[model samples]
Target: MSDADTARRALALLDLTDLADVATADGARDLCRRAVSGPVPVAAVCLWPRFVAVARQALGDSPVRIATVVNFPEGDTPIAPAIRETEEALEAGADEIDFVLPWRAVLAGQLTTAGAMIRNVKMRCGDKLLKVILESGEYPDLDKVRVASELAIAAGADFIKTSTGKTARSASIPAARAMLGVIGMTARPIGLKPSGGIRTLADAKSYLALADAMMGPDWATPATFRFGASGLYTALIEEIGGAAPGAPPRGSY
Candidate 1:
C-alpha cells in the first residue's frame, strides 16, 4: 500500500492515549485538544479514569470517543475494585472501558477468575464497549496468549488487547498473531488492539498488515481494530500530511 493509504488507515483507527503517571488536567485537556486538532481525526482517546471527564469535556460534541483503563497495566486487581473502577469511569463519561484481564490469575491456572472478572465488568458495561487487556507478554508462550484471548472473548470482551504499554515487553508480532488467530475464529464480532511500543507509522502498518492478512483487507476498522498509543499520532500526522508541530508528547497507560 502507498503511504497515503497506510496513513489513512492508521489515523482512522488510532486511539490517542495519555495514561502517564504525571498526567495532569492540563495534559488531559491538551491531549483532547490535539486529538481534534490533528490533520486527521482519531477514533478515540484512552485516558486514566480521573481524566475521563476532562477528556469528555474537552471533546464536547466531537465524534471522537472517550476510553479509560481499569485494572490498568498490572492486570492483578481484585474483582471488586476492577468493577467499581469500570462503573466510575462510565459514570465519569467514558465511552469505552479497557479492563485488564487479570493475567496473573490466568497464569496460575485460574481461568474462572478471569472469566468472572470479565463477566462482572461486562454486566456493568451494558451496551458500552469493553476491551479486555490480555497483557500477552505476561503469558509464558503463544499458546497461553491464545488461551487468554479465547477466555476474554467467551467471557464477553468486545475486543482483545495485547498489552498495557507499561510492561517490559509490550505488543509483539508473534503475540498479536496469536490473539488475531482467536479473533478470526470467534463467531462474535470481537476486535483487536495492539498497543505499547507502537510509536511509528511503520509500527502501526505492521499490525494493520497482519490484520488484513488474517481477517481480509476491509475487516479492520475503527470498530474492529485500534492502535493504543500516545506518540504514534505524531508520526501518522507527519506521514499523512507534513510536519506535526502540535502533536503531544509520548506517554503510557
Candidate 2:
C-alpha cells in the first residue's frame, strides 16, 4: 500500500490514548479533538476511567468510542473492585473497557483466579467491548504469552492487548506474533492490540503486515485490530499531510 493508504488504515484502527499520570479533563478534551481531526476518525479514545465522562462529552455523538482502563497498569486489583470499576466506567458512558489481566497471577500458575477476574469483568461489561491487557512484556517466554492469550480468549475477552506501556518492556513484534498465533487458532472473533513503543508509520505498518500475514489481508479492520498508543497519532498525521494539533500528551498507553 502507498504511505497515505497505510496511514489512513492505521489511523482508523488506532485507539488514541492518554493514560498519563498527569492527564486532566482539558487534556482528555484535547485528545478527543485530535481523534476527530485526523483524516479518518480513530476507532476509540482510551483514557483513564475518571475521564470517561470527559471524553464522552467531548466526543458528543462522534463515532469515536470512549474506552477506559480497569484494574489498570497493575493487574493486581481484586475481582470485586475490577467489576465495580467496570460498572462505574460504563455508567460514565464508556463504550469499551480495556482491562489489565492479572498477569502475575497467571505467571504464578493461578489460572483459575485470572480467568475468573476476566469472566467477572466481562459479565459486568455486558454488551460493551472489553479489551484485556496481558502485559506480555512481563512474560518469561512466548509460551507464557500464548498460555495467557488462550486463557483471556476463552474467558471472553473481545480483544487481547499486548502491554500497559508502564513497564521496563512494552509491546514488541515477537510478543505480538505469539499472541496472533493463538488468536488465529480460535474460532471466536477475538481481536489483537499491540500498544506501546509504536510511534511511527513504519511501526504501524509492521504490525499491520504481521496481522495480514497471519490472519489474512482483510482481517485487520477497526473492529478486529487496534494500535493503542498516544505518540503514534503524530506520526500518522505527518504521513497523511495534516497538521497535528500538537505532540500527543505524554502517556503510559
Candidate 3:
C-alpha cells in the first residue's frame, strides 16, 4: 500500500479511554459511547478490571473491542501478580491488555525482569492482544525505550504503545520515530499507539503521518497503528463535520 493509504488505515485504530479517570468499566463505557457516536469511531473501549464487562455490554458486538489495563498506570508489580491480573482481565471480557513495563526494574538494569513480565503475560493471554506501554515521557533515555520495544515485541506484545495517558506528556512524533523504527524491524506487523493528551484531530493526523513516514505502507491501519485518547474524539468530530454539511452535535462518550 502507498504511504497515504497506510496513514488512513493507521488513523482507524484509535481508542479514547480517559486520561486520569478510574479504571472502572462504567466510566470507560461512558467515554466509549461518546466516541462511537462522534465523527470518528473508536476501534475499542478501555477501562479498569471491574468494568471490562460494562464496556462489553455497552459496546455490545459493535466490533469495538473491550480493553483493560494490566499492572496499569504504574508498572511496578512483580511478574506473578501481573500475570494474575492478565487472567482476571481476560475473564472480565477484555479483548486487549495494555501494560506498562516496570520502570524501576529497567532503571536498575533488570532488563530480564522487565522482559519476563511481558513474556509471561503474553503466554497467559494466549491469542488475546497485548499492548506494552513504554511510558516514554518518564524515562530519560531513548535506548531504554528501544530495548523495551524490542523485548516487548520479542516477548509477544502485539503493539508497543507510547504512554498510559496519565503522564504530564503524551506521545511524541520523535519518540514514535524511534519506536516505529524498532517495530519496523519485525515481520509480524507490530502496532504503535501514541496515546495521551492528543486532544485534536490535527495531532491525530500528525501521528498518522509520522507512522506512515516511519513504518511504510504495512503499518497503516488500525491493525498496525492505534491512538489512545480520551476527550480528543469530541474535537475530531467537530473538525470533521464543520467543513461538511449537516454534522452531528459534539459528544462526550
Best by TM-score: 2
Candidate 1's C-alpha lDDT? Answer: 0.89
- What TM-scores do the predictions have? 0.97, 0.98, 0.86
Please name the candidate that would achieve the greatest lDDT relative to the true structure: 2
Clashes of 1: 0
- What are the per-residue Cα lDDT tens digits for candidate 3 across 1-253? 4433333343357675653453444456566576466444667766677777777778776777777788877888877888888998898789999988786677778888788888889998888889999888777778877877887888789998988877786578777888988987898878888887676666777887787677664556767777886565545555454322222122212
* Separate clash counts for every candidate: 0, 0, 7
State the lDDT of candidate 2 residue by residue for 56-79, as single tens digits. Answer: 999999999999999988999988
Sort the predicted structures by TM-score, highest score first: 2, 1, 3
Model 1, residue 249: C-alpha shift (Å):
3.4
Candidate 2 vs 3: which has more lDDT: 2
Total clashes, candidate 3? 7
Deviating ranges (above 4 Å) for candidate 2:
none
Q: Tell me the deviation in Å of residue 206 in model 1.
A: 1.0
Q: Better model by TM-score, 1 or 2?
A: 2
